[model samples]
Target chain A: MRVGELSRRTGVPVPTIKYYVREGLLPPGELTSPNQASYTDTHERRLRLIRALLDVGGLKVAAIAEVLRAVDDPGRPVHKVLGAATERLGARHAEHDDQEAAEAGAAVGELIERRGWRTDKSSPAAADLARALAAMGRLGHGAFREVLDDYAEAAERVARADLGYVDRKVAVEDLVETTVIGTVLGEAVFNAMRRLAHVDASARLFGTRPEASD
Target chain B: MRVGELSRRTGVPVPTIKYYVREGLLPPGELTSPNQASYTDTHERRLRLIRALLDVGGLKVAAIAEVLRAVDDPGRPVHKVLGAATERLGARHAEHDDQEAAEAGAAVGELIERRGWRTDKSSPAAADLARALAAMGRLGHGAFREVLDDYAEAAERVARADLGYVDRKVAVEDLVETTVIGTVLGEAVFNAMRRLAHVDASARLFGTRPEASD
Candidate 1:
């Protein structure tokens, strides 16, 4: 199909698709003529992935480009840390150069050690956790850190389940893209469900309908 | 303290503080003179909260304004859904009026029912879930839908832990702000941890260090 058909089918504009092509987020279509190019099903899938990362994962174009580059690299190994995906998460921020950041970093270190998870504190995900924990301290919600254990346990279970799903359903060739999608869009899925679950818990606690509103 | 002191304390610039004040995200400081205003500790905390929501939660200024409005509403009930916070999440998007949306909506409804959650399908969180699910479908990872059950279970666990944290750590008067922070920033914490856990799981499965890079 042509670019126009690809845009119509995916609900993306032609100009936006061209922009993605220009950005190398989507591969250039095969040239059929001097002025015409033909896209494929692969282009459609890649386009949707780009949009999903932008809209749902809240990732920047530079981050998406990094992850996609990893995906398209034939030599890139699978089942390794998806550094780009982790670095691009919403919680991602550099460790602050201050006492508060130092303390948050220590707390994150302790959580990883206590959880018995074989990981280091310098990973992008750890920096993300440290930054978020530090922000909570600034917000005067430092006591909220008590739930870190529970959250980490839940994270492990979900990660295991996520890996299990990909192991069963995704082929080795598709592992990188599947892992990227599962890591990014999967966060959106879990965030939404967590909010929904909050309503249910609140309904149980307050005895009001979950849809009870202001 | 004065505006300069508040800006210094929170690391927010004077112009940004004025902008937030004009936007009603921060209450105006008390006027001490024609050109100067005195701020309180409350101003400092509110500024930090606003910045955290903007930076960590990835919320728009308009959404932060809405959430802060609810936090200030004296009549807003405690232990109910923090609807504004839910509406402002990164996954947030209007439900599309199309066949794909309808199917995703149905899938989300089924998950809610299966989990025995008390929420309805019309909530902001539900719409977020449906949109994310539809995006996954478009990416040709529709098989990813099979993991919804596991994700929902983990969400419920995390949400319950979140409410418990708030119930114990937050005073009744602070419930609204606490809930909003917990909802928005807590998602960041969980997302980061999940990614961290993914790295650990990958390391274990692939027999490598979790921090192994490209």
Candidate 2:
């Protein structure tokens, strides 16, 4: 197929496809002649993945490029690839090494020790956790840490389910991409579910329906 | 105190504070004299909340303004305020009224019925859930719904913890703000913890350390 057909099939504009090719997010098609190139099934698949990451995952082009590099690199371990994909899902911010952030980082270290997790304290995910906690502390909600264990328990259950689903994939080659989709889109699924549950729980507790108030 | 003091205390720059005021996310200071304005303790608290919502919550200024309006409206029900705040946390996209989206919406409706949740299907959260499921289906992961119950269970646990914390607040006036904070920042906290737990669970399952692979 040519770029025009690819664009028509995927609903992505031709120029955007060319832009993705230019940005190294999508590979260029084989040139049949001057100004004529052919794309394969793999290109179609890759283009869909790129659209999913950009639209639903809300990843920037540069971050998507990094994630794709990790995804395509066979030398990288599965867990490392998963880390690269998941890290990009987080809000990118400069690390604040202030007193509160330091305290929060120490607390995160304690949580890791208590949980016996085998990840590094310097990991971006760990830093994100620290930043969130520090922000909470600044807002006078420092006691939110009291419920960390519950969140961890829930997280463990969700992670188990996630890994179980990924492990069931028949092809080893499909594992990394499946993991990336599960992590990014799965977050959206869980967040929406949480909001629905919040409505249900709040209604049960308050004896008032949210829609009724609307 | 003055606007300068509020800026110093909250660590928000004066120009940004002025921007928030101009955007209606923060109230204007009381004019004490020509070219001099006084901000109260309420101003300080609101400034901190604004910064938290902007930085940690990742809400746009317009959405923050709407949420703040809901929070300030004494006539609005607590559940309504919560619904308003929670709805804004989702990615605001135009609803895809295609067949797959309709099927996904039906599945979400069934999940709500099965779970006995009290929210309407028309809610933004429900629509967001449908959109996520539809996206997953497009990605060949429609079976992701197989794990919805697990995600819902975890969501219920977290929501219960959230409501319990809010219920413990001494002032009725503070309930809405607390719910917004819990919904937004609590999500960041849970996501980080989930990633950490993923590292642990994947390590145990694969017998490989993530950091070792790094």
What lDDT tens digits, residue by residue, belong to model 2 across residues B2-88? Answer: 888898888888999899888888889999999888999888888878877777777778878877887888877778878887876
Report backbone clashes per prediction: 0, 0
TM per candidate, chain B: 0.91, 0.94
C-alpha positional error of residue A15 in candidate 2 after TM-score superposition, expressed in Å? 2.8
Off by over 4 Å in 2: A94-99, B212-214
lDDT by residue for model 2 over A1-214, one digit each (tens)?
9999999877789999999999999999999999899999889888878887777766779888988887888877777887877776678753455677888888999989888888878787787888888887877787787788778778888998888877775268888888778877888888888899999999999997766434
List, in the given order, the native-contact fraction of each candidate. 0.78, 0.72
Give Cα-based local distance difference scores for all models.
0.81, 0.82
- Using Cα atoms, each model's DockQ against the true complex is 0.70, 0.69
The positional error of residue A71 in candidate 1, measured at the CA in angstroms, is: 1.4
Top DockQ hit:
1
